[model samples]
Target: MLEPRLRTMWLANAASGAAAVAVRTPRPVFADRTRTPRETVVASDLELVTVTDHSAVLTWTTRARNRAGRLRPVPADTEVRITSADSRGAPRTWFFEGLRTPYHYAEIRGLEPGRSYRFEAYSDGRRAVPARTLVTRRSGTPESTGVFTTATPPPGRLIRTIALANDLHYGEPASGLFAGLFEGVRHGTDEYPEFMLHALLEDLRLPDRAADHLVVAGDLTDSGTAEQALGVRAQLDDWGELGRDYFVCRGNHDVRPPDETDHWGNVFHPRDRLLEYFAGGLRIIGLDTTRVRGAGGTLAPAQLAQLGELLRGEPERPTLIFGHHPVTRHAAVSNPGGPGFVLDRANAAALHRLYASAPGVFLHHSGHTHRNRRSRPDSGIGVEFLEVGAVKEYPGGYTLIRIYEGGYMVNFWKTRSESARRWSTRTRSQYLGLHPDHALGSCADRNHVVLRDFSGLSG
Candidate 1:
């Protein structure tokens, strides 16, 4: 059986008298693909990516049309003016005029906590916004109440941080695919997987809040081809050692068919390997959540049995588990809940029992729905069931989990590179412009603090 996207195309071909012909869609090597430079600049796709206590990343894309009248992003200076009403009825303003680039990632800092801000943007100093695309649940206009707010910082002496990301879909032609129903959207940045992944790695290395480790929950590739797997590893290598500083779990896309030459397993760990890392008393576990060519996820009986044993041995260790499925869907999360989008219900119940037995597993991270969500399900209400957005699509980036002796903070951070921002903004066309409702979860979902006693772990 073929994937939904491939099956759709296959049926179409079969109907056209090529029933025996098999279609295999492939993308160029991730490192080999590059973006075409744009010559002109027209600002569009402005959005408030996410807001934090003292900082916010405001992004917009600058585009130019070719002789063929095709619109593509081009480099341009990023300029913005944010203002808030003061107590005296005057406007308090903050400004950021930044690097010239097609993907305008403007970082706004020094914002007063809990303050509302409204802003306008420019490409090359031209008031080019009222961008054609609007972030969901917000007005398109610059001055509307759709503006975002800066919230108070989570309190704790930040001990350490982990960067969480997934669904890179390397070597894929496009995203947002539905079986014979909708066409996928190509990335604005041609080599999108590299573009977005690189942005995420660079952001992780930033000085003020650098991540101590990185965990890709799953879906590191589009096709389980060796080239895609190695390509993803090379990108991860640029940040840290393969099995040390960064770790990856298998996603369904990384499962190669048995008859195919794509040996994804040779490059990545198997589902039962149960990769575990401990740093300063904090235990992080990466689970191989996928089965070959299967969209829904399950823990093989052996894998679940192994995890149960590990939790039983040190059930009180401060721990985090990262996998590829949403576990079990409940109303606390988004609407993409279905059998295919998560682990099997019975398997999830078994995992819930393991969580119940292990009091130290405070968080579980998973991805596949290409959205950002955090839920506390009934089965394991004490555990944080978080679904981070795809690193290769709209709202592309990672979630930072900062541990403190008293508690931990989970904050989503969108990649801040020019090409990455441009591509992420363009991919918002998903779900007929309703993607934000699914992908850009509420600010609370994107950023929040969980108070727990982690005094046993050093930050």
Candidate 2:
């Protein structure tokens, strides 16, 4: 069957004759075989793209005109009229601004969590699309939106379990590479990166699976703007106390724009070189590998020496290192040259040498490639160099680190909230229209266990 957007258009009989007509608000008009007539206001693709406890995204497409068959520009003041699906409350309207094409998108906020909602699209105060039903996804589901919840949140004064997310790209304009290069791409359909991060934060704080601590490895923002950096921190603040409950390091995108002053003020300055925090018997080290705007990462000689010293100080203690770029390469679609996808070979080798001798270190996590992958360093480092997909776009999620007396394990938990999954699935198109599973990664990327004696670490 044809999709909803396509089905919205119909061949209605005309008063003058049985001419092929596409439905329009006032009346049906001639159906352009090569293009959608300007009067054809709506087509099939109307559907909910994502839903969180308090927010949801809806998108649709309209008919186009001209020989090129380009989408007719969407009418200004297009909005989504939303109300409780059960009609328990008054309706609210969400609007879009600065939109340019036939694709219509809007995000509805201020909704109640776990509540169902009904919404319809309108253009210039006229109904542009039919009403649809949506249910806000529950928080903390294990695998999918309707599945089981994760393990219970541990009590205070227990072994600290930290949640890990990287490559949030808070101010990223588009969710995927070449986002605007294709005509199939819908304008403003994807959720804002900040919204995606907000949903991920909700997952981090879910009951029974609450993270005692949170660590963002790198690439917190797309261009390291003050607004993006501050936006990232603001979202984290909504989760818990910063420094005490959470910490973040920089990615290549998080580098300051090489200016003395920023629009968001000095608090948004990018000077977090590295962070070392202790959780129970685990030493978590976050390294800033971004060396000012280069796509790949490089450690300054000073930072490298500092890392060596930090590792040598307590080689017997358990340690987990994280950065924005991977130390080892993985099988992925994009294979760029230089230090673009993975860390500099020399830097990775040097770090591998350090960890190989430092028995305390067992895992090295990074995120920049925006895909899940796992590989042990080639130099026999005994450490898992794992790269996680982006949390701001497809495969939205974070890694859950559970420390036990005998050992620790890392699991990649996809942000399963309905909104997260929808955006994740939708943005998979940004991966060059590849299958969702291609960007989602395999089971090996989801769960892994390593047995090692970590009894010496404090619980």
Candidate 3:
């Protein structure tokens, strides 16, 4: 038999679970003159969210006040236990540390596909409320079973599709204008590098079953700072085996200031180093988009000529073009004007004409305005232009595009949690001086549009 105290605790926990269900329903809270012990001790805000393939990230906040009603941080050494239900129907436990900021986070990996798992966190060995998640399929060869649907089978013939992510501005101090633009943005507790690495890895791992190529559109570094570039490279090196066959293009942020050099001699040029690293199965074409004297991206006369030559001579094999700025008019955040730069309008026209003349170019990927948009600029051209979303701004997600025989499908996943969305709204209001809805709308526009029929060749 359990002691009286243990029995009371168990009853209180049961009542709390019942209350949680009640709260989730649409209802108003009634004030009770007397508060239950369970009400005061129970933690609030538990969320089980999936981050990417084969992993679910769990986060929760603890009750701030003790029974006495004095406010204090949760114990730093608090233990969080997460369990995954295995094939045998047994729970497997994974342990993590509970942070004192009243928050706890844990990531569970090595999960089996199409399975459901239940988990619970404990503070000082006391079981907390349970959370659950359903693990889904990761990247795999397209195969169908009688019980399930699958993508079309791989041609067994090699097909290449590139994964593109851009505008990660790591280590950049938040500016008031930029903050207002994002409004209530909040970042996870992990450092910028960790957040980026984790997110990028998740994105890359998605196509592991299908993609033969990967491309980073641009803005690899935030301020074009040497140290930041080195830090970026260090993170890239960690994926040692995956590092091979990835293409990189130059963004305005990747070049040196114009006063320093004509080319990127003064700065840490990731484009050159990336070329050396991905020698085969990857074709990286670098472009100088930054203006030395002012703001706005540009392609000089000589550079434009070179680009024309390259596109004209590109091999018949599958190819993906990566640059910082988009070639289409709809990609700009603000309208293009005099002294305002956007792919050098004339250069953009020339490139479109060139792609129209060349049938080999299948896709052109870019990331600058920090939005996701796909379009077929020329009906005659086989190329599809894809603008990837920014990691540092509104909607704050990346695009996962799966290339198959008939065509491709692009899915956009936003990084906004309830907490993150609130943060983003506040940040944008304070920094960009914009309303939350307006910012959200802009983000939505960028992420929602999809373009089909790339080649216009089939029809």
Candidate 4:
């Protein structure tokens, strides 16, 4: 959603071997046919996808630098050398043996919590630079250089787990296309959207990483075309049954041109009404924050009234509301973004007021900003507004929410599959080498534990 989408006229990219199509009127939808597929920048570095009380997932990709401003993927054996930071034990190395692929992932487990461990990655036995230590601390200390803490899961019985994701942007063939950010970047050979989503689905399908349910926040399309929308939906259909195993909300790009022929609107947001569902004692709500041909968001007076009434009816039931646009001013102003980046002040204030009254509403999640951030506009309002990073690009992944009897935990994980890791690594130079700084949030923002009273909720 950070990219420029041409309106009224389409621009062709012969480099991508595609012709652009022209459109008309207040077109806020995606210009899917006009995008330039090849990225012109490239970078490669090892990263900590995520760390936990007992395990850590480290991933990276190898690339061959290019003087012509595009790097090609290079195969290299993957390995990670790890040891106790204190040097109290013999060092160990783990590997994805027998594979010389561009993408690499090494998972280390069985470490003690509240302790630190030193680790480094190797490409074909060559040590990766800037070796760092992983501090799996539970002491509630602040994060420091090269050392991040684990996700402090709540102390109690875990009842339900939800996979939180947004901005799939299916049908788009490339990423990091917003500005001249493409300078020196290299786009993935595979269709970027499908590549990312495939990795997500595969990761979520793993036994140890599965979730009880899934929530796709919004932007489920590159442009509001029937083929694009249906394609994304069909892929998701393989994940599980819609409206039961998973749910979706619409985004600005998902909005089609105001034409009766556009079936994408009918396919997804027929009524633009709030979607209410449940997983045991937890209540899930999906709000449609977008309007036709508009980039920002709104909560109509009638919709607000309805939401207030619904919350009042179940004042103490734990609830989570999600949408495409951030709802709180703290979230809106947390980063340097343009107008229409969030909900207008009026609707935000109204939602905050409702949250102040409904003690059960704990979180409001959004994804347009494509960053992992948490905010509370008013401490007294009792709602945490969270903006999760996009699934289609750099730092590509989803947020996992584990609701416990006592409270909840939030942790973000980067997709570790071959195509995803390669694409993610190559896109770091986006926005002129500043994309990582803006998209990759601080450790605290990506992982945290919040205590709340949820005695009434149980699986």
Best by TM-score: 4
| Model 2 per-residue lDDT tens digits across residues 1-459 | 222221221111111112111211112222124543345454423434444334444554455354676644343334565554566644444333333345454544444544555565655444554212111122322111222111222223235577878888777766555435544333284446776787677666555356888877788777767777677777788777766677777777776666545332244324536667776667888887776556767788878898999999988778888887777744222433334657777887798789977998988888877766776566766787777778887667777777766656566666644455556656645545552444444444555555666667676
The 0-to-1 C-alpha lDDT of every candidate, in the order given, reads: 0.72, 0.59, 0.46, 0.70
- lDDT (Cα, tens digit) per residue for candidate 1, span 1-459: 223422332233233222112221111111111434336567766666667666666666778888898987676655555555333332222333333567766665656677776666666655545344333335533223536667655555778888889999888877788766668787544578877787788777666457999989888988888888889888888789877788888888888886776556777775456888887888888887777666878788878888998999999998999998888556224455466668877888888888998999999999988888876675735898899999998888899888887788777878765566657777777768778777877667887777898876785
- Could you estimate the TM-score for every candidate? 0.80, 0.63, 0.55, 0.81
- Please give, for residues 1-459, the per-residue lDDT of candidate 4 as tens digits: 111211100111111112111211111211133434243222235566666655566666666656675567666656565555667654455323435666666665445555566666666555554212222122332222334344556778888889999999888766766645354444546478887887787667765566888899889887778888888888888899888888898888788777645555567656367888887878999888887776788876777788998999998889999998987767777666654678888888888888888889998989988888887665477777889989998889999887887888887888766667767776765676676667766566777778887767767
Quote the lDDT for 281 in model 3: 35
Which residue runs of candidate 1 sit more than 4 Å off their true CA positions? 1-44, 62-77, 83-86, 90-92, 98-102, 112-135, 138-149, 187-190, 259-262, 331-337
Rank ordering of all candidates by TM-score, starting from the highest: 4, 1, 2, 3
Sort the predicted structures by lDDT, highest score first.
Answer: 1, 4, 2, 3
Worst 10 residues of 3 by lDDT: 141-150
Q: Model 3: per-residue lDDT, tens digit, 1-459?
A: 333432332344344335433542212222222433343334433333322323344444445576788644353222333333333432323433322334444444444434444555544344444222111111220100001111232222223444566776665555223424342334555244345444554445433323444556667666666676666666555543333645556676666664553232333353332222222333445555655544466667776776567666754534456677777665543432223545666767777887776555667777776545564473467777777656655434556554444345444544422333223323433333432222222222332212332332211
Q: Is candidate 1 or 2 superior in lDDT? A: 1
Model 4 gets an lDDT of 0.70
